[model samples]
Target: MSKGWWAVVAVAAATAACAKVEAPAASDAWIRLAAVPGRPAAGYFTLHGGRADTKLVGVSVASVPRVELHLSRMTVGDMMTMDATPAVDLPAGAALPFAPGGRHAMLFDVPPALTPGKTATMTFRFADGQTAAAEAKVVSAGASGPE
Candidate 1:
């Protein structure tokens, strides 16, 4: 092959290698306020994985005080319960949903300003040092999750 053609091929390979991959992202985030005041609210969202696998280590809410990852499951007695989880797996090119009766986030110490129709900033931390933040809509306790 000609030298000039070889140079062009090398540059093309380099460009493809240097292409940037999209980072993990969070979307459709929303919070459902507790039925009673002073209780923890439920947070739901959709997490889109990046080009690599990672784990969701933690979550933080700008308007709330504390947030914890949780997994809900039904016991042998046909009763449902939720327990705190340290991390949740985030596979590459997958969409993980934090919805009702499954994995979710427990937001504590939510303020009055995060009432219905309001939005709050929620940041998600990943084990790979990647972080994602999204504005979560606030919904009333009696209402279902995001439409």
Candidate 2:
């Protein structure tokens, strides 16, 4: 084989190796609740991927009646808005953070008496049909700290 042909072969092999799907790292994940008046509560967290090409498909919380992934953005008129995101993509070795005024999870219809410091278990579903459970502590709205 010529030198150029060998070089091409090596590059192809490297590319293929890099393209393999890796399992997501479910550890070190957390969600913080943000205060909202007379509406559903919002939570933010960091989703870290152990390997490349992992996407978060769905999320469910036992505490809340319903949970969904929501993306909040500002419209042209400087109005804040939100919409449901089908999925949140987390590339390998990447962390997708849900923060205030950004991507977050919506916990709808929470019980009226729910309070901060309560712990809720959430199951996160990934694109590869894998599910991981994460524990989130409820905090008061505007309580900002490390997630």
Predicted model with the maximum TM-score: 1
Give residue 84's lDDT in candidate 2 (0 to 100).
97
lDDT of each: 0.94, 0.75
User: lDDT by residue for model 2 over 1-147, one digit each (tens)?
Assistant: 799999999999999999876666554334455466546777666777866576899888776778889998999999999999989888878877877788888888877566777777778889988777777777777667433
Q: RMSD for all candidates, in order, please.
A: 2.7, 6.6
lDDT of 1 by residue, 1-147 (tens): 899999999999999977977789999999999999999999999999999999999999996789999999999999999999999999999999999999999999888888898888999999999999999989999889765
Clashing pairs in 2: 25-50, 35-141, 51-92, 52-92
Worst 10 residues of 2 by lDDT: 25-34
Residue-pair clashes per candidate, as listed? 0, 4
TM-score of each prediction: 0.89, 0.72
